[model samples]
Target: MDCLNCFEITARLHMYIDRELNSEEIAIVQEHLEDCPSCECRFHFDMRIKRLVHERCTIQHAPQHLREAVMRLAHAPAGTYAELDPELVKEIKADLKGGG
Candidate 1:
């Protein structure tokens, strides 16, 4: 297979990391990554992000009150979200930290 250019390699990077590429395509991308420092760094960063999200995030149903609060905040004026219950805000912040 011909060596892939940076653009082509990057365009298919997610697929490569997800193991969706055929053997020939994988070999081409692997070769490009080996030769290109910038592309390699980007690939590493993307892989790290994918791993972090997969490991830290979970599938869960949001509570009705929390869902309602979020929907209200979403539709509210940007700076007007202060009307949301402070306790809920604190809970959300704590949950985000715990997940991270």
Candidate 2:
């Protein structure tokens, strides 16, 4: 399953690395990885990066106020949560392109 050079596939690489991919997409990524060195390296790199980050970072509870704010927003209209944290999203997009 050779994937096109598209954003959807890029978005999915992170999901796949996180084990958040659904079954069908998982199968596609699994097949693609077997044949695609670039994608395979991307997967390995992302996995290693995340693993190292987790290993080094101490787990800390989210502040009570932050949790409460999220909880309050959870019940809001669907579009309310649509906005992404630009900085984090940029980091994700950059990492997907093999640029840390």
Candidate 3:
């Protein structure tokens, strides 16, 4: 099988991490990830984010501000959220603690 490039692997990252891809696709993605460190790092980061959300976000309806903050984080590039604003990260952490 031809190795998948970064674009293909990243494009399917969410599905791959969620186990939504079929066996062959999973094999292809796994092969690409094993060969490419950059994609692997991104995959791990996304997995952490997904796990964090699953662990913390149990409420049926999040507040508007919380939702907005999450959207901001979601749109941000990997590892850029804290660099963009450490204060915002702190605030979010505090809010999550209080809300929990």
- TM for every model, in the order presented, reads 0.57, 0.51, 0.56
* Per-residue lDDT of candidate 3, residues 3-85 (tens digit): 77899899999999889999999999998899899999999999999999998997678765667777877888887733435
Each prediction's whole-model lDDT (CA): 0.88, 0.71, 0.85
Best-to-worst order by lDDT is 1, 3, 2
| Residue-level lDDT for 67 in candidate 2 | 57
Q: How accurate is candidate 3 locally (lDDT)?
A: 0.85
Candidate 2 residue lDDT tens string, 5-72: 54556668888888897788888878777877887888788889998998889686654554555666
Q: Which stretches of candidate 3 lie over 4 Å from their true place?
A: 60-100
lDDT of 1 by residue, 1-100 (tens): 6777899899999999999999999989988899999999999999999999988896787767678887887888877634768888888777778877
Give residue 35's lDDT in candidate 2 (0 to 100). 76
